[model samples]
Target: MNSLLITSTEESTGKTAIALALATLASAQGASVGYMKPKGTRLQSNVGKILDEDPMLARDLLDSTDDLAEMEPVIYSPTFIENAIRGQEDPDALRDRVAENFAHLATDRDLMVVEGGGSYTTGGIIGLTDADVANVLDSKVLLVATYREPGDVDDVLAAAESFGDRLGGVLFNAVKDADYDRVSTDVVPFLESRGIPVYGVLPRKRELAGLTVSALAKELGAQLVTPNVPTDGYIERFVVGAMGAEAALSQFRRTKAAAMITGGDRTDIQTAALEAPGITCLLLTGGFQPPGAVVGKAAERGVPILLMQTDTMTTIERAEDVIRSGRTRDEETVASMRELLAAHADVDAILQ
Candidate 1:
């Protein structure tokens, strides 16, 4: 079977997104696909067993019958890191478990998409780094590079050098409109000249990257003050209400489907946000109960008011964490992601 290892230069660069998209494309072409994440870093407990989030997502999306436990063979729990650092955990044993699980999942499959934990060098301590796992599976590497600035090219080049001939190609993800010209006219040509193949350049779409109100509420441990708010509604931008009422309104007006974060006591800011178009939700901090008038107005405007006990900065940090770790579980987002990947990414080249 042909195997591909999907990894990134850093975390939250949409490695899973690209992997899932490729699986969909491959399935459309009548190829049977299998997925496995050898070393899972994002640990969550479902009932009694510890599980990784991405493997479960893959199981559901790909319609795989593999047991969740087997699909994610190794989970780095809170104490796992501590144990590994102190020489309590054995790297060889971990590798054996991963290999055993991988063999089981890859049975009767044409392609196996193995996802890495974080970056290329993330699991070095456990001897299961991206390159290590790729070598173990005899898989070619397709690195997902998130475009932040021009300097990001250096990071991608360095990773390419590390992978050597094992590197299949590079996919440029989340490229903003402003950087498209440079990435296409400059970066792509530059990389191609250096013997690196550029497989895709996907543009940034807010809907694909933004957090939903339901996700935000869950992340902030927030209480919904408004009844029957659409939790699935996407918040494309976040505006902190630290300025005066007019300034806050002006800022909020700049983006669609914005979530305004403000102190609960700031009725002026609250009122301004509610009045603005495309204000999907309000995130009230400091545990202060919003006045009944503001709540009533929000209810009237059909805007969800999420109340949290944390302070403003803490609230912002929590929101950032949610966005960074968030994935698209909804069908709408999934369809858009597939469309984007199929349009921008060279699926033919990847499958070849």
Candidate 2:
């Protein structure tokens, strides 16, 4: 079976998202697509069984028949490193297990998409880095780079150099509107000149990147104050209301589908956010509940109000964590991602 190793320069570059899109496209073209994450770092406990979240998500997205344990194979829990240091886990044996599981999973498949854990250096502790795994599996590398700034090109090039001819290409994702032209003209050509293929340069779509209100509430461990709001509705941007109500309103107005983060006592700011356009939800920090009138207004507007005990900074940090690790599971986000990839990415080149 032909295998493609999907990895990234850093974490949260949408490695799984790109993998799912590619697998979807490949399946549409009649290829039997299989996916596996050799070493799972985002350890999850599914009813006492340890598994990785990415493989679970991929299994559902691809409608694969493989069991979760088979799909992930190697899970690194909080105690894994400690056990390894104490000689409880054998690195060579682990490698063999990963290889065995991969071979079994790839059986009868036309193409297998192997997702690397986190960055290229992620699994070095267990000797299963992205390049190492790719070499072991005899698969080509397709690096997914999240366009943060001009310096990202250098990072991608360095990765390409590390992969050498094993690197199939780079997919530039989450390119902001301001940097689209530069990425298409300068970044793409520079990478190609260095012998790296540019398969796709995808623009940033807030709908695909944002976290839903339900996800935010779960992450913040907050109590929902407003009832019956659409938990699946997403917030594209975050507006922290630390300033005066008037100033905060201006900042909130600039963002579409924003989750307004403010102190619970800031009734002025909370009211202003409710009045603003594209206000998906209100995250009230400091454990203080908004006035009854404010809650009534939010309830009337069908907005979800999450009340948290944490301070503003801590809440913002947690929200960032949620957004960074959030996946495109909802139908709308999945469809949007597939459409974006189909339009921008060279599916024919990717499949081959």
Clashing pairs in 2: none
* Best candidate, TM-score: 1
lDDT of 2: 0.84
For residue 320, model 1's alpha carbon misses the true position, in angstroms, by: 2.2
- Model 1 TM-score, all chains together: 0.87
Cα lDDT of model 2 by residue, 26-130, tens digit: 888888989999878776567987777778778877788897787887777668877877878888998898888889998999999999887988778778889
Worst 10 residues of 2 by lDDT: 325-334
Clashes of 1: 0
Q: Per-residue alpha-carbon lDDT of model 1 for 66-89, expressed as tens digits?
A: 888787777876677788999998
Where model 1 places Cα greater than 4 Å from the true spot, the runs are 218-221, 228-233, 236-258, 266-280, 296-303, 309-314, 330-332
Listed in order, each prediction's TM-score against the native is 0.87, 0.86
